[model samples]
Target: MSQIIGNLSQIGGDYDALFCDLWGCLHNGKQPYPAAVSALQQFRRAGGRVCLMTNAPRPNQYVIAQLDRMGVPRDAWDLVVSSGDAAQDAMFAGAVGRKVWHIGTEKDDGFFTDIPGEWANAPAISRVSLEEAEGIVATGPFDEANEAPEDYRARLMMARERGLVLLCANPDVVVDMGETRIYCAGALAEFYEELGGQSLYFGKPHPPVYDRARRLMDLGDEARILAVGDGIRTDVKGAQQEGIDCLFVTGGLAAEAFGPDVEDPDEELLREWLATQQMAPRYSIGRLR
Candidate 1:
């Protein structure tokens, strides 16, 4: 049973660090949440470490630039980790071959250009048509706001028939952009799997992202770590599998399921919903604060 908590301070002392999610928990993709920023700042002030663990399909540098633009304070977090880091490692190592079909808008092109220094001798990746590609690299939809998973049914069917593997950079299915929800790379991955295509996931609820984050968040006493995020499937499930306590932020994705008030999640509804999803977070919060 996940207990509904008022704030992060209640369990702050019990943990040594936090694996925090980005989008709905810290910001709505456009700006920073003042309360959420304060909560992380307070946690840092009390000698806790914060790693901004995100499923964003871009390198840590790109994410840092985004945070800066969003006005998320530098004091709020100690380090950053991303799903792109893990997926990029595998892609460069020839997990999906050298030639691939690229999905995602021009903003996500950094994923192709921003190769880490350590992988200097990695196989060069190139973008090609679906017919000439060795594999598929899907960051997200070319147009996230207006596109749906079914829109690529025929394309995915063609890729599936070719037996090309898809490397999913981000594993989040949907994200709330302020008040509007948009599909993410995970939706396309799900669709490909439904079409009998092979899709490899490297983000939350998968071990690759957690493994990379753990390596980056190296601490002497690494046992006490808390995961704070809104995605039940991505955040809570990932933390649970990693054997860490999670602070489920109900106000983000599942705000309506709890009740009318985003600040005060209905305990009965929260418990029932967690049971239905088969996830068990030790604690729950209406928001990150």
Candidate 2:
């Protein structure tokens, strides 16, 4: 069983650096959680370095701008690392000079620009149909609110028939927006794989993003870094694989699974869920604060 923690302060002394997830832990897509923002600010004030590691399918700069708009103070974190950065890096390294169909929202278009030549040859990215594409870069479903993995069945089938490779930018199966949980790019990627299509994932529960996070944090000791997030599949599993202590937040994405007062989750249910995953966090909290 994971120990329940009241706030980050209670376990502040245990870690020198914090690798915190951005989406559910700090905000719910619409706005920032005041308590969570303040907690990270406080953690930073106490000589702790915070890296806003996220699975957002956009570059770190884009995420920083979004954070600013959401009123998440710049002082709250020391650095930012995102799956978009990892995806870009991977694309630069592996997909250079290749053409790919961008399967995502209009808001996700920024992911294709400003490629640095120092890394790898910039590849040509298009929003054209499957017939014109050599591969696919799936950021997420274009219509998250009204769509599901099944909504992409036809398109994925077409891409699969074309023998296209898929690069999944945000490897999150679902995310909570207020009280609504919507399917993400990971779900589509999973479905595509189930259809015998080859897919590459770039986010939590994957080593590339974690390696990027570690490098961005520049923290020498992995053991001294504490990972904080809500997703059991991504955050908890990622931290465990990275050999870092993780603090799970229950009131974020998995709120419904734990029952009422999600901040103070039902221990038995939470434990059962963890048991199924064969993973556990060092500590659990209702929220990041």
Candidate 3:
């Protein structure tokens, strides 16, 4: 069961830090959510640290650049802990082998070159054809919006036959690019596993991303932390697995499922939806604010 709330302030004081999701709670893919921004600034004013924890399949700098283009102020967060950064660490450490086949677009180039300084001595990883590679690295599809997981079935079948492991950069099956829904790398990874191939994830609902956030941010050992996001399977489940409290935002990806009012969720419907889910947040809100 989950209690529906109106704003972050109602329980913000209980936590010393917030592990906030970027896509739906703080901003849409195009711009920042003003109310969410103010809530975060207030959290910081009260001496709380805000970590923009995200499952975007790009390094922190690339994400920061996108946030800048979207006009999200830097004051709203203390640091960014992203799945791309964590996955990059694994890639450099040879988790996916040295020679790999990439399934992504040019926008995802940063995943290979924009890694952290600690990996300066990392081995020189090369991009090879599917037939010549030892593993697969998926950031997203070449056509994120227009393609489906099944679109890669033929190629994936080849990789499966060769026993290539896929390193998933983002574990979100799909996300709303404003009003349009787009598939992410997680969909392909899911499809690969369904075809009997191994897929490794470094994002939400997985340990690597949370572990990376812990290593980067100093949210004091005694600090009370709360995870906030709209994705039930990713954000909420991830928080639970990490042994932390979570606040579910209904106005994001599953806005319609919670009722007609995206700003105010219908409690009965929310509870009913939760009953069907394997994971439920302790608290629920229409939006981050």
Candidate 4:
């Protein structure tokens, strides 16, 4: 059985660094949770480094701006690492190549910035349509709030026919945006895969993102690192696979399985849910507080 913690202080001294998930753990896209913010702030004040690791398909600066707008204190985290950053690294490393068809909103263009080369620097990314590109990069649906995977059926079919490999920046299927849940890029990638299109993910539950976070933290020893998040598939599983202990919060993303409202989940119910998912975090909490 997993121990339910009311405060993060119970295990704060056990870790030198924390790789914390952004959306579900800290805020729900609309605003920051006061308790969650205070918990991280408290942890950082205790000498532990807090790195906000997120699958958000935008650059770190965009997320920082959103956090600022939401009134989340700037001191809550020491660093921010995003999936878009990981995808850009993969793109420049010849993993996704230079010529690509970007299938996302205009806000996602930040991922295609210039990269320094050994010579006069490689040209900036050449954005082409599905018919002219060698690969496809998907951040999310063009209209996340109003579109679903079915909306991209025709587009995905065309890409599949052209044999364009997909590089997905965000691995989350759906995200809680304030009071509403919206589809994300991972949902589209799953549809593309079903259409026989090859896809690569650069976010959570994938080793590349975690590897990037570990390098950014530069904290030695995975044993001294604590992973915190709300999703079992992405956060808990990702941390466990990375050989780091995880702390799961029940009130976000996985709230449905925990309880009907944002209260402590039934211990046995949570245990059964984790058993079904084949995940057992080091600790479980209703919220980060």
Candidate 5:
């Protein structure tokens, strides 16, 4: 474990660019954390460059628009990179003369619209259709309240029958959609894998997402970059895998994971949890704000 540092001011002097995480550290899926926003603004004003990185499945433009609505100004960070952006990059890389059956909301169609590919909507296609399709992209239409595991199972079975490769845009199983937890593309992908389907994931908790962020920031191997987020599985694990420092915000995924009784887990308890996981953030705080 790396030596944990408590001061935010120390971060400003040590790192060249910050690869910050969204969803948990910056906001709680409803509103932006005032303290966190102020800290980032202060960091930028003090000559630090911050690159906001998120696991949001939507394209960069959409993510930025959402953040803007959430009161997080675009100028808070030097750059923004999302899982959607990386998925789009991967699609473009292998999409020459290929047709894709995109299973996602209409908003996500924007990610593939201008790209060099054809789109199709088939819950299940025949082997002939599989021969026609180069790949299958699942973005998430599965709402836990409306769609069940059977629905995803049936769809994956159909895709497998046709021998189509699967690409999961959002690797998150669920996200805080206001007060409710809604299913993401990852949930469907996981079920598909259980049924003997091949799936590729692109997002945080996965190394590729951080790798792309590093490149975007022009960060070298030894560059000190802090990954601040709420979820231990995604933000914390992702930073640890990349060998970068991290700051875990308490009010996100681990809120209840820490315990329902304790609304605010102190720094010592947080440190104990990190020690148990073999992961330690350079710092830990109650909320991003």
Candidate 6:
């Protein structure tokens, strides 16, 4: 593992392109981290191609607007690709003229606004059996808090039995929605897998989305991309699996995970943590900023 004392500038040399994660690495969803933003600006000033990749269940434009609202300047990155964008493209690829059952919050429905198809509140709206559904597009968390969780499970089983393709718009299982921890569509997708169902996940930690971002920058797989984010499951694991380096920010997840006592965990502690998991990142930082 390599350690750089200060900001990203300390890391010598310039990369041809950079594939960055959005949520925790760029901002905490509420506000942008000044240091992180400056780091990106510095990288771009050095002529590095930066692509902001996020697992948000919204289109690229929506993600960009959110970044703007969070105070992250438009020049922070060159391009953006959201998990929702990939899911929407995939959905349209298969069912161009068919109807679909959208299982998500109203805010997420904007992804399907321009698609050439009809929307059904529930799978039963089309009088089509779960097996007959052209495809299942899942966006947000569906639980008692917001929606009925049982209804979500039942829909998954129906889709599986009918051999309907399941498309996950949000790849994150949960995120820090400001001070509140809320579940994402990824939680339901995991449960569906446990029940022997097939699902197509679009988001961080998934190779396809990363591949798309790389293509956008014209960078090959050998590019020295640093995946920075606060989520261990998505940012770290995703980077490791894709054979790239990573920088883990400790400001997200269970914020309690890092403290004066546990801060700067020794190599042994890091190894112990990785022993229980299938992947490990190359380095860890307190926070990007």
Error of 4 at 29 (Å): 0.4
Name the weakest run of 10 consecutive residues (lDDT summed) in model 3.
Answer: 214-223
**Which residue pairs clash within candidate 3?**
none
The count of backbone overlaps in candidate 3 is 0
Off by over 4 Å in 4: 114-120
**Global lDDT scores for all candidate models:** 0.93, 0.85, 0.91, 0.85, 0.71, 0.69
Of candidates 6 and 3, the better by TM-score: 3
Better of 1 and 4 by TM-score: 1
Better of 1 and 6 by lDDT: 1
Clashing pairs in 2: none
Error in Å for residue 49 of model 2: 0.3
- Write candidate 2's Cα lDDT for 1-289 as tens digits: 8888889999998889998998889999899999999999999999999998899998888999998988888999989988998988777666522577877898888788757566544445445567787788889998988988887788888888988999999999998877788888999899999988989988998998878777766766544889999999999999999888999998887777788996688888888877887988989998888
Candidate 5: pairs in clash: 35-289, 36-289
Give the best candidate by lDDT. Answer: 1
- Model 6: weakest 10-residue lDDT segment is 119-128
Query: Candidate 6, residues 123-192: lDDT per residue as tens digits?
Result: 2222134455676677876341455345577777876776766678887887776666777777777777
Once fitted onto the true fold, the runs of candidate 1 whose alpha carbons sit more than 4 angstroms away are: 220-222
Estimate, for each residue in 1-289, the C-alpha lDDT of model 4 and write its tens digit: 7789888999999988889998888998888889999999999999998999999988788888888999999899999998887887777665656689887898887777534243126555778877788888898988987999999899889988988889999998898998899999999999999989999998998998888777877876644888999988889989989888899999888788877656688888898999998998989999888
lDDT of 5 by residue, 87-174 (tens): 7666666632247776677767667753422323312222124346667777886354476456766667877887667878888777
TM-score of structure candidate 2: 0.94
* TM-score quality measure for candidate 1: 0.98
TM-score for each predicted model, relative to the true structure: 0.98, 0.94, 0.98, 0.94, 0.82, 0.83
**Model 4 weakest lDDT span, ten residues long:** 114-123
lDDT of 3 by residue, 234-283 (tens): 99999999889999999998899888889999998998888888677999
Residue 117, candidate 2: how far off, in angstroms? 5.0
